[model samples]
Target: MPEQYLKKILTSRVYDVARETALVRAPSLSRRTGHTVWLKREDEQDVFSFKIRGAYNKMAQLDADTLARGVVAASAGNHAQGVAMAAQRLKCQATIFMPVTTPAIKVSAVRNRAARVRLVGDSFDETLAAAQVFCEKNAQ
Candidate 1:
């Protein structure tokens, strides 16, 4: 990675919304690989995914005007939850485009975070296209 970008990441305020999850010993994986191993306990997060770090960091860096205008995203599960969580923290509206086939649990999770949910197409690609079109139409 470039030095400038690395510095930005190092200085990120991602912790404002994201927890520093632990690295837990992974005995099973270690046994299989015949080496010591550890797994990041990202599932310990409120969103239950490490996806929240990136989502929160990206949103945190957005200009206030842009945040006021709201944010949009496309995802089938974790990423949607991450964005929704970040939106709630940042006090920004979020519209998440998800595939129609996405599980009800995940959809409910996004809504529970106060983000509007848009059930789009059957595949990730189609859902992404809908989100892109929405961004273009809204001039976001």
Candidate 2:
């Protein structure tokens, strides 16, 4: 890897919401594969999703006005949860657009994090379209 990219990654502010988690050795997998194996415990994160790092990093870069205007995104699962968790931590409103086909548990999780869940469309593509409309209307 290039030194500059490595430096940027090491200096990233994603640490505010995501801590440095140690890799746990996958002993059985390592033995079977004849190679040392390790697994990152991103599940240990507050959102139980690795996507929180990227979500928080991007949102953290926004100006206060933008954040105050709120965030809107389209996702049925992990990304939705991450955005919801990040928004809650930042004290901003978040609207997650998900397909009506999404499971109740997933919807409940996002809502639990204080983000609004909008169940639109029967498929993910339609759900994304609905979120895009929100972005265009809100100038996001």
Candidate 3:
């Protein structure tokens, strides 16, 4: 997509929200490895990760009718939180799936975003399968 046209389609407020994220220089890692290293400081985000940026960006593009129908997504960590936050901000229902072994931190992160969290299967693949089934059944 053309960058300028794409920018116009997205709401300015959402972009503002994402812009608060920091881009931290990786001084220690760079020095240790003798390589250029930098970290996109998504950890400073409102939800404490980069997920919000992509999630909000995607949800912000959905039409009203589709938003009313809600959205479903499967993710293990950061992406899940991002999707959940985006859905909540858009006032669209969100269903998220995480593997059974996902750390509590990740699960809590999504829950804190007000996104419904479901623990299923053992690996990302299995969790994704369950999420797909749920989405199909829910008609999301």
Per lDDT, the best of the predicted structures is: 1
Worst 10 residues of 3 by lDDT: 8-17
Q: Residues 71-119, candidate 2, lDDT per residue (tens digit)?
A: 9999988999999988998999999999999999989999999999999
List RMSD in Å for every model shown. Answer: 1.8, 1.3, 3.1
Q: Estimate each model's TM-score.
A: 0.93, 0.92, 0.80
Q: What does the lDDT come to for candidate 2?
A: 0.92
Which sequence of candidate numbers ranks them by TM-score, best first? 1, 2, 3
Stretches of model 2 off by over 4 angstroms after superposition: none
Q: Write the per-residue lDDT of candidate 3 for residues 24-114, one digit (tens) a residue.
A: 7898999999998888876777777766777887788889999998888888888898888788778888888999899999899889878
Q: Pick the candidate with the highest TM-score.
A: 1
lDDT of 1 by residue, 35-125 (tens): 9999999999999999999999999999999999999999999999999999999999999999999999999999999999999999999
Predictions in order: lDDT: 0.96, 0.92, 0.82
Q: Which stretches of candidate 3 lie over 4 Å from their true place?
A: 1-16, 33-36
Residue 135 miss distance in model 2 (angstroms): 1.4
Residue 131, candidate 2: alpha-carbon lDDT: 99
lDDT of 3 at 43: 72
